[model samples]
Target: MSEVLEGVEKAEAEAVQIREKAQSQVEEIQRDAERKARGIEQIVRTQLTKEIEALQKSVESKAKNKSQRILLKADEEAVSLEEQGTKNIKKTVDIIIKGVYAFGGGGK
Candidate 1:
């Protein structure tokens, strides 16, 4: 009966040690998972920031290009109008000269 009691006590002590070790492992695993989750979140945030910046740059470049094209077209139209005005002025001068010389029966 004394031997039986010693065997039961030893088994209970071994069970207690096993339970403590398992608890420690569980805590370590939980801490590691939390750390990995934080690292992934940071990486995602950084990547998203870069992508957003790139998109903004792309949009700005397109807008600038469109503005330049509009300005160039306006300049071309101004030049065309100036050329037409110059031609009209020459025609008017010729008409005035003919009118001034009409008394002498001279015309161009």
Candidate 2:
């Protein structure tokens, strides 16, 4: 009977050790999962930041190109108006000269 009691006590102690080991393994698994989740979150944030920057640059480039086109068109119209004004001035001067000559004011 004494030997049987010793064997029972030993079995109980072994069971307790097994339970503690299982708990420790569960805690380790939880820590590893949390670390992996944080890494994934960081990677996603970095990718989103890069994508947003690229989109902003594309928008800026398009706006710059459109503004340049508008400026070129404005310059062309200004040149056309200046040429028209010069031609009209020359015609007006010729008409005035002819009138003065007809009035016999050319000798003076």
Candidate 3:
């Protein structure tokens, strides 16, 4: 029965080799999947940072525009008030002059 023993030994050796090859393939696949996952994570983080920066810039621009408009409106109101005050002063001066002329007042 020497031939029977040799056949059994060869079959066991072939089985061991097949098992080792399958384990190696499984390890390689796991490593590749982990690498791809890390790459995706980095890309997402970069994109989010850019979007946040853009949003902040937009908010600042709008705020500055609103502040400028408010300042312009205040300036316009101040100018209008100054013009009215000058007109009132002129009217008062004219009235005083007319009263003095009506009376006989001559200062030399």
Candidate 4:
């Protein structure tokens, strides 16, 4: 009966030790999982930042190109209007001179 009691005590101690070890292992696993999750989060954030920057540059480049095309077209239109105005100058002047002579009751 004394030996049987000793055996039971030893078994209980061993079971306690096993439980402690398992608890320690679980804590370690949780810590490792948290560390890995932080690392993955950092990587995803970095990738997203890079993609956003690239997109901003692409949009800026496209806007610049569009603005350049519009400016060039406006400049061309201004030049065309200037040329037309120059071409009409002689006729405009002649008409003005004829009107002045008629208003003065003089021969042209």
Candidate 5:
């Protein structure tokens, strides 16, 4: 009977040790999972940042090109109007000269 009692105690002790070891393993696995999750989050954030920057650059380039085109068109229109004004001024001067000559009787 005493030998059976000792054996029971030994079995209980081994069971306690097994429980403690299993608890420790569970804690380690949780820590490893947390670390991996953090790493994955950081990788996703970096990728998003890079994509946003690239999109911003593309938008800026397109806007710049559009602005340049608008300015070139404005400049072309200004030149056309200036040429038309010059032609009108020459016609006005010729009309005035003819009227003056007729009124003055060709300077007598």
Candidate 6:
């Protein structure tokens, strides 16, 4: 009877030890998972920041290039208008001179 009691006690002790070991393993796994999650969060944040910065730079570059093109086009249009004005003025002066010569008396 005493031997049977001793076997029961030993079995109970082993069960308690197994429960404690399982609990410790569970805690360790939880801690490891938390650490990994933090690492992944940081990596994602860094990548997002980089992507945003790159996009901002690209937009700025495009805006600058567009502005430059607009300025150049405006300059070209102004020059074309100036040349056209000069040509019109010259034509007006030539017509006036010929009319005055005709009025001053007929040329032989």
Write model 5 residue lDDT over 2-108, tens digit each, in one string: 99999999999999999999999999999999999989988999999999999999999999999999999999999999999897998878888888888978731
- Window of ten residues with lowest summed lDDT in model 3: 99-108
- Residue 36 CA displacement from its true place in model 4, Å: 4.3
lDDT of each residue in 1-108, candidate 4, tens digit only: 999999999999999999999999999999999999989988999999999999999999999999999999999999999999899999889888998999889745
The digit string of per-residue lDDT tens for model 1 on 18-59 reads 999999999999999999998998999999999999999999
lDDT of candidate 3 over 1-108, digit per residue (tens)? 999999999999999999999999999999999999989988998999899999999999999999999999999999998998787988878778878886877521
* TM value for model 2: 0.60
TM value for model 6: 0.59
Candidate 4: segments with Cα more than 4 A from true spot: 35-42, 90-108
Task: Estimate, for each residue in 1-108, the C-alpha lDDT of model 2 and write its tens digit.
Answer: 999999999999999999999999999999999999989988999999999999999999999999999999999999998998787997878888888887985622
Off by over 4 Å in 5: 39-41, 89-108
Q: What's the count of clashing pairs in each model shown?
A: 0, 0, 0, 0, 0, 0
| Candidate 2 runs further than 4 Å off | 88-108
Estimate, for each residue in 5-97, the C-alpha lDDT of model 6 and write its tens digit: 999999999999999999999999999999999899889999999999999999999999999999999999999999998979888787878
lDDT of each: 0.95, 0.91, 0.90, 0.96, 0.94, 0.93
Which regions of candidate 1 are displaced past 4 Å? 81-108
**What's the candidate order when arranged by decreasing lDDT?**
4, 1, 5, 6, 2, 3
Predicted structure 5: lDDT: 0.94
Name the lDDT value of residue 19 in candidate 3: 93
- The 10-residue segment with the lowest total lDDT in model 6: 99-108
